[model samples]
Each structure stands twice: as structure tokens, then as C-alpha cells.
Target: MQNKSIGLFLVILILLSACVPTKNIEELAVVTARGVDITEDNQVETMLNIIRFDPEADSLFTSNTGIGNTIKGAREEAADRTSYNLVEGQINLELYGKEAAEQGIFRFINGLIHDSQVSDTMKLAVSNVSAKEIFNIENPNMPAVGEHLDRLIEIEVKNNSFPPATIQDFTRVKTTIGEDPLLPLIGLVDEKPTIIGMAVFQDDRYVVDISLDEGFLMNLFLNKVENKSVEMTLPLQPFEKYKINTIGIESKSLEGEEFHINFLTTHGKSNTKVESLEQLKFKTDTYIEINLTEMSHPISIKHEKAANLLEKEIEKKLKKQYEELFKKVQEANADVFGFGKLYRSKTKDGKITEEEWREKLPYITVDFNVDVKLMHTGTIQ
Candidate 1:
């Protein structure tokens, strides 16, 4: 009776297992990154980085390309060239070519939004040249190109060096009434993928590219700045008046030498105000506390006003930079700063369309008030 009972249990277990379906790992091609581009023939080109399950492969992943009418169609063509089933559930990054971005990215992004398998946290970037060129790069140090780029952007965003541009973030900005979208721009520097700048977009169309310095300033406006470092080069002529003469001191001359300072572990906050709704004017007050980590030349700390003067110089330089960056955005007619949100709130109906806001953007005036404080001058006596 005991043997019969055990035999019946085994039969039920086998029946339950047979009801489920499974595929061998070798039969799956797991995609970690995808690149989309438009060919000269106007066909959609798709590049995929797939993880290899075979132990005999030289690299952990391989890249392949396919051209078709649409992103889905292109990938289907790529699948026909491989025996393994192409799976996109693990995709960590998606890149768009310059031409695709210029033509507009909403159509491509719409497909991603509807895909149930794609993760909301997947990162998106724009390639300065072509996605195909980026995928073709072979770096000995980076065996897995997709994984390397994924980790690179993650670390840079965490360090506050680059803007956060995940799919979720992009969707939020795109759907928001008063804001525009920005993406990280990737380029090939010495055959290695590098974060060159931020790609500014006006209503899904690529407008302009801003340098990383300008991107950092944008980060200051959008989010709190903490644990960030900034390097500045100042005119050394002003520091000549503050120089001290020590009997045994031997220092370089201030003539034709630029003052370089590195601010480390900075913390800052920014507050925006609608100065005049009718006049289209706004004001932003920014406060920052910096730790002076390194300096090209030393100033006499015996004077009580030395630190104050240094702080003032930094404030002046930063304020100018902010103004210049704002002017660039205005010229491009892209309101990446979200100033329109303030204007919209003050409207009588609290309604402002993107087209109306863009028309008002060029004439909008902003006053940037920057205050810099030197909290610690590391060992620079």
C-alpha cells in the first residue's frame, strides 16, 4: 500500500511539471542594449547587444544589426539571422541616432511606452554621430559594451555629473505641460564611448547640445546639489594685490597665469520666483557652500577680507555663466528650466500651451542671484 501511494505522488508531480513550458538558456538571446538609427535609404536600422550563453565565445556579448521599416520590424529581421530567440526584457540602455532625434523621437518612444517587457528605469541617450558607428566600436578594456555604458551613465548621474534621463523621467517631462526633455549625448572619443554633453529637445525634436558645465548648472536648478565638484579658472591679475611676501617663499609669478580652483563636496539650493507675470520676468536665488580642495596659487589668509574676496570672485563668475547658459536655452527656444510652470500658475486661467510658452520664451527675462561661500579651504594657509 505504501509503494502504491509513493507511485501515485510521483505521477502527479510529473503531470504538474508537464503543464509548464521552459526554454533552454542557450536558445535565448538576451538583449542588454539597443540602438535605433535611420539609414540613408530611410529604412529603420536596429543594433542589438546580446549576451552570449556559450562558454566558448571570446566576448560575453555580441552585437548585430537589422534594417526594416520600423523598430519592431527591424528587430524581427535581425531575429531571422539568429537561431536563438531575441529577448528584450533585460535591456538596460537605448540609443537614438542624431538623424532619428532630429526627425523626432516621440514615434520611437511611443513604441517603448506600450511594450510591456521594457523596464521603466531603462536609460535613453542620443548619439552625436550615428548609433551604428557607436555599436561598431571595439574597446579592449570594455568587453561588454552595453554593460559598460549602462554602468558609466549610472555612476555619472549618481555623482551629479550628468542629468538623470531614464525612460520614466523622459515620460514625465514629455507629458508635463511646461517642461521640455533633455537627454545625455554620447560620442566616440578615441574609439571609446564618452558622455559629451546634454541633448536639448523642444517638443520631441532635438534643438541643441549644451556642455557638461551647463548641464551641471541645470542640475543645480532642477535638484539639490550635494557631493559635487566644480573646477574654475579665474584671472590671476586680481590676486596679485593680495599676494604676500615671505622671506623663504618661492612662488610662481601671477603674470599670464590663470587662477584655478577646485571646489569639492559642494552643497547648494535654488529658489525661483515669478517677478512679473505680465512682463515675463523671473528671478532665481542660488546659495552654495563650497570646500576649496585645490588651488593653483595661494592667497594671504592673514587678511580678514581674503576669503570674502575669493567668495565674491566665484559668485561673479558663476552668475555670468548662469546668464550665458540661460541665453543659449532661450535662443534655442527650449524651456528646459521649467520657468513656464511658474508663468502658467500665475495665469488667470492657469493654462498655457507649449506653443504659447515657446513664443514667450525668447522675450522672458531672468535675474540670477548667485551667492558663494567658502566653508573650508583645505590646508591652504
Candidate 2:
């Protein structure tokens, strides 16, 4: 009787252990990337690109779609189809459609962050086209769609094509009182991933899209990146062709009641088409002036006519852009530029609330000063 009782106890323990056993690799599907968009009917839509390893078959590409009032609901719907558990840790990129961003991306992304499975390090990007288009792009030259997109991001980072903002970085900016978040805008051009420019958002709502030039300048102002490539075209005497590549821009913000940012840039020779030494020097100065003007426009120049012209141009353009961006933020009531934080830090009380800051931002003044230096003419000079 004692032996039989012991045997029954052992059997019960074995059954409990089996029920709580660890999951095997074969019972999991890895998600490489995900795309989110709002459908025409105003329903939330999501596409998950799942990857799984198989010995007998090639790696599988399984796409699942879900529609719901919220992203969580859609994710729950997607979760029902798989026998194997889906893992979000394997995902590296999250792409959002233009409509979804304009509608409000913060709510959906907040859902993703709160989910236990999602990784915080994943890269976030806004699609110039629809998220559906990005998910559907197929190029034969690339290894896999996910891998291709990942490689493209890597290349862009390496080339300094744009500032790097991971999911966590974006979340920090979004939730912070003063700062707004910016994301790179990606699109498929001829079946290839292209970094078009940048998407600026005030909280969850999309405010405005900026071109590469503007994006680069914004990056410089934000101190997000170091090295960048800039091309400036200058008119050479007697139709002599010349171009200069400006690199290594250093910027600093002034400490005062009004916001002022000063930038100093140095140019190096990528190409110069002048013959004599004097002509080379003249062309270099010309290139600097033109490029500086291109960067900033409209200032009164009484002295140092050539250099002053450039300064005025840059100052004018930058002021205009700053005003435009500030207006957009004020209208949206989003503090994407971190002006609130600046005000708080500058204030003696250090207790400016969001509402108070918003009211004061429109009245705030910003000044920009640009200085350019000609580092080298090139190998020929």
C-alpha cells in the first residue's frame, strides 16, 4: 500500500513538470520587421514579416494581417493564427505609414513599448509611401527583404545620411515635456530602399516633412550627428567650373533669455577647376561665399561684402525656417524642439510648465550666426 501511494505521488509530479516545460526553438517564429498603417476604412492594419528556419524547406516568409480598433487588438488577432509562439525580440525595425503617422503614431507605439515581448532597441522609421508598399517591395539583388532594409539602414548610418534615432530615443523625446521626436522617412524607389528625408512629429501627430538639406541642418542644430557632406556651387571667373564639399560643422547654443545658435563650418576640396594659384584662392573664397549663402539668406552687408553676403543669406533663411517650424509646433501644441526645456533651464525658478511654455514660445526670439572657413582647395591647389 505504501509503494502504491509513492508511485501515485511520482506520477502527479511528472505531469505537472510536463505542463510547465520550457518552449523549444522549433515552437517559435521570429519576427524580423513589422509595418503599421491605417486602412481606408479607418481601421488599424498591421503586417508582420515572420522568419522561421526549416531543414527540409527554405526559410519561410509568412505575412499576417490584422484589423482592429486598436493596435493591441490587431496584434491579438495576429497571434491567433500561429501554432508557434511569435517573438518580438528578433524584430529590428518598425515601419509606419504616412497616414498612420499623421493620424497619431504615439498611441500605437506606446502599445508596442508596453508589450512584454517588444524590444526597446528596435529602429523606428516613417514610410514616405504606405507601410503596405514598404512591406511588399521585393528586389532580386537583395538577400532578404528584412536583411535588405537592415543593410540600407546600416549604410545610411555609416555614410552619415541621417541622424540615428532608435525606438527608445524616439520614445524619450515623445514623452518628454519639451522635446518632440523626428524620424527618417524611407521609401521604395525602383524596388530599392531610399532614405528620402525626415518626418517631424509633434507628440503623435505628424507636423511637416522636411527635405534632406533642411533635415541635415536640423541634425546639425540638434547636435545629433558629426560629419556630413555638403555641396556648394560657385561661379568661377570666365566660366571656370568649381565645387566644394563642406564637412565638420560645429554648433553651439548661446546662454541667454533669447535662443541663439552659432555654427562654424570648414570646407575641403572635393573638386576645384582653376589653373593659377591666385585663381585657385579666388575660386575657394567664391565657393565659400556661395555655399554659405545657400545655407543662410538675407542680411544687410556693409563690410566684407563677399563673406557678409553669405552670412546674411544663411541668417535670413535659417530665421525663416525657424519661425515656420515654431509656428507649426505652436499650432499643434507640441514641443518637439525642446524650447520648453531650454526656457526652464534658463529661467531662475526652473519650474515652467508645458502650458506656460507653449504660451511663451510664440513670443520667443531665435538668432542664428553662421561662419564658414576654407580648409583646403584640394590636391591641385
Candidate 3:
């Protein structure tokens, strides 16, 4: 009886194995990155960076192109070009072209949201040029364009230079009332991919483009930054008395009429509050501990009075930058800072509409209080 039962079990195991579909690694085309662009004729064009498994291939990755009226259709068209099964489960990055971003990104992003194979943590970015052009870029230094771009944005976000922008992050902000989404803006500089700044979205449309400096400030308001850098050019006339005089030594000074100081923030935080809803007044308190990394002219940081002067100048400069950046954001009516969310939270119903916030954003005022602490002089007095 035991021998008959063993034979039956073996037969069942063999039948189950034969019923399952088998996939070979060498026959699978793994897509690492996807780029979406709208053609001049208003058709969807999808470019995929597919990993090549053949050991004899010239490169580890290959580009596959397809065009259709929809993303899924384009992708299916792409699959026909390759003998291997096209897979998107490994996609680490998604990029939308300038045209697509301007038209609206939610539609392209919506496809990803419904697909269970794609990870929510994958990074998303907007390109100033066509997404196809970005994929075609050839940089010997960047053998894998998709992975390189992913790492580039990852490093910048870790340094607090760029804000976190994943598919999940974007969708969350889009669904939330009184808040908007922002993504890293990438462009080719000298024929090489580089981070231009950030794309500010009003709802799902690309409404405004902000500079890298402005993006850093947005990160300060939205995130806790461990390291941030700011460069300031001050009038040399104010520090003329602090210049060192070497006796009997003739030298040409490198400091021009303008004195430049570079500060590296060791820690940074910004807190915002609704001072008055009726008056449309808000207050933001920003505190930063910075280290002096570079100084064109020597001003003794050891001296209390001189250090305080430098701190005050840094505070004033940062405040001015924040105010100017906020003004631009307000003009575009893109609430990337989530100020409207704060307003909603303070309301009786804790609810606000996009149109309502847009109408009030232009009129709302924010008082900025910047406090700069000189932490270290970086081996310089």
C-alpha cells in the first residue's frame, strides 16, 4: 500500500510541474526605465530601456520604441519588436517629456497606478526636452542612462538638494486638497543629462519651473535637511575695515569689490503656522546651523561682533530668497508648499477646494523669520 501511494504522489507532482508555464531568464526583456512623449501628431510614444541578458551583446541595455494612442498600446507595440517577453516589473524610473507634462501627467501616471507589477517607490521626473531625446543621449561616463539618472536624482534628494518625488508621492499630493506636486526637472547641458531644477505643478499641469536654489528652499519648508549650501555675494565696502594688513608685504588681493561667502548648512528646519485665517496671515520660522566653507575676504569668525555681523547678513539674504521664491510660487498659483493644506486644517470643516485655494493664494501673506547660527568656521578663523 505504501509503494502504491508513493507512485501516485510522484505522478501528481509531475502533472503539476507540466501544467505551470515556464519562463527562461534569457528570454525575458526586463524594462528598467520608461519614458513617455507625445508626438507632433498627438500620439503616445513610449521608449523603454530594456536590460539585455545575452552575454554576447555589445551593451547591457537596449532601447525599444513604440507608438500608439495609449501607453498600454504603445507598450504592446514595443513587445512585438523583441522576441523576448517584455517585462516592466523592474522599472526604476519614469520620465515625462515637456509636451506630455504640459498637456497633463496624471494620465500617464494613472497607468502606473493601476499596474500591480510596477513599484510605487520608483522615481519620477520631467524632462525639458522630449523623453525620446533623453533616452537617445550617449554619454560614455553613463553607460546605463536609466540607472545613472535614477542614482543622480537619488543622490540629490539625499543631500536635500531635490525634493522626494515618487509616483506614490505625486499621487498623494494630487488627491489631497489644497496641495500640489513637484518633480525634478531634467535637461541636457553640454549634451549631458543634468538636473535643471524643479517642475511646479498646479493640479496635474506643469505650471511653473523653478531654479535649483528655489528648489532647495522648498525642500527646507517640506523636509528636514541635514546639509544645504548657499552662496552669497556681499559688498566688500562693509568689510573693508576687517581686511588684514600685512606690514611691508606687497600683494595683490584676490577679493574683488564683492565679497563672496559660501555656507554649508549642518542642520535646517522650517515651521509654518496660520497666524490668522480671516486676515490671511501666516508665519514661518526657519532655523539653520551653517558652517562657513568659503570666504573670498577674511573676516574673523572668532570675533563675536564680526561673527554676529556675518550671521545677520546670512539671515537677511536667506529671508529675501525665501520671500522671492514664495512670490513666484504664488504668482503661478502652485501651492507646492502645502500652505493651503495648513489653511484647510485650521478651518472648521478641515476641507478646501483647489479653486478656492487658488483664489486665496495670491492674496495670502507669509511673514518669514530666518535664524542663522554660525556653527563652525571650517578650520578658518
lDDT of 3 by residue, 1-381 (tens): 999999999999999998889878888889999899999999999999889797778887888899998888999999998888998888989999999999999998898889998899999999999998898998787766778789899999988996798899999998788889999999999998888999999899898899988898898888888877777887676666667757787744546787899989899999999999998899999999999999877665677787888888778888999899889889998888898999999999887788888899999999999998998888768
> Which candidate tops TM-score?
3
What candidate 2 gets wrong by more than 4 Å, as runs, is: 1-21, 40-42, 142-146, 234-336
Native-vs-model 1 lDDT? Answer: 0.86
**Leading candidate by lDDT:** 3
> For each predicted model, how many residue pairs clash, with residues at least 3 apart or on different chains?
0, 6, 0
**Per-model TM-score on C-alpha atoms:** 0.92, 0.69, 0.93
Reference-based lDDT, residue 4, model 1: 100
Report the lDDT tens digits of candidate 2 across residue range 178-283: 5778888887777777778788887767777766665655555554343455543322221111112234644222222221222334432112122232121101
Q: Write the per-residue lDDT of candidate 1 for residues 1-381, one digit (tens) a residue.
A: 999999999999999997788867877889899999998998999999999687777767788889998888899999999878998888999999999998888888888889998888999999899888888888777766667778888988999986699998987887787788889999998889888999998878888999988888888888898999999988777778787666787855665668888897579889999999989999999999998888777566446588888888889999999999988888999889889988998889988898888888999999999988888877765
Worst 10 residues of 2 by lDDT: 278-287
Q: By summed lDDT, which 10 consecutive residues of candidate 1 come out lowest?
A: 295-304
